[model samples]
Target: RRRTRLERSWRDCQRLWKWVSKKWLEKHRDVHNLKTIWFLRHPFKIRSGGEHKCFFCAYATKKWEENIGNRPPRTEKWTRCDYCPGRLVDSKFHCINAQYHYFNHPDLFCKEIERLNILRLRQETVGRSQGRPHA
Candidate 1:
């Protein structure tokens, strides 16, 4: 029984580590490289998302299509994923994930936008032959 408990705890740590690793890789793609954002609770907004069943924000992405402030979200306020037990801080990690890769690869980001089924968002990104702006 003790072994089983330890194994479960180890698995929990591994899951958190995986999330952090994903964020690190995302940072390499994004600029802030450290910023994190909250997750939009609407399952529609989240791909491969599960029922966290809470409020969400619809801010804008790039082209000015779907976003937190722009997109319509549920009104019922609930605790964010970060506050949930064993729930890694998806917001900050997510915020960094979004902004980092946004402009550098608009095409890929655009593809993601389509995946999200939101309208095209305008992303003025650098990192190509264009001068990388000091943001």
Candidate 2:
């Protein structure tokens, strides 16, 4: 049987993810945690004439939406944004902003991630001190 376009696109996304993961691992050799590398999908909508545009950046495209009206809504898995490298998370594309900041202002992104990690560590410490089970 022939593969559907959606299936092909999914395969491409998996390949892209693998490449990104490999690059990230090379850069952060000591950090094996994959959670820090977020893949997010930007917010988009299909208009009356099959047009689509990202809500956040107003990036417009019609290339990816072929036969979109016949396809079921994507809810269970991450979908790549047509405009950016981010994948969809919870139907939102907040990772696009993160990736943009990561490339354009590396220090800012690193600082923010560090701050968040510190806060998380503090919370964990507090929880452990209170005898709460690790979540």
Candidate 3:
């Protein structure tokens, strides 16, 4: 029984280590590479209180031609409107994960955007040179 308990504890430690390692990698990867904003939650936007509006503002009343705010959210955190009058503290703004990336690491975000833009320009230039229709 002691041996079994020890094995279980060891497994738990391994699981925790794996989780930590994965989180570390994800955080580091975000700053190191340029990635397209995902459209799965496309037009992602977070209001000043934590409300996710469309991809840009906190004031959106709909999401992608559908009603979103009327339904009860499954999570407790989502139940309350983040932007409801004075919910946010000074020095913080409601922002989505992608927005957080820009807010917390402007330099990294700028670098990624610059890199992606340069790549895109190169692709466009190549296409133009090859007589391909401008995309």
Tell me the number of clashing residue pairs for each predicted model: 17, 5, 3
For model 3, how does the per-residue alpha-carbon lDDT over 1-135 read when each residue is reduced to its tens digit?
Answer: 243322332233233323333444566444212222222323423333123212222222222123345555664324233421112221133322364344455444344434444554576689899999654
lDDT of 1 by residue, 13-70 (tens): 2333334345555665442232232222111332211232111111111112323354
lDDT by residue for model 2 (1-135), tens:
675433333334344334444555467432223323322332223342122122212221233344345445774221324322222212233433655254443344344434444554576689999999643
* TM-score of each prediction: 0.20, 0.30, 0.29
Which segments of model 1 are wrong by more than 4 Å? 1-3, 28-135
Candidate 1: deviation at residue 70, Å? 60
| Stretches of model 3 off by over 4 angstroms after superposition | 1-100
TM-score winner: 2
Report lDDT (Cα) of residue 108, candidate 1. 43
User: Which sections of candidate 2 miss by over 4 Å?
Assistant: 1-94, 98-100
Model 2 pairs in collision = 40-87, 40-88, 41-87, 41-88, 41-93
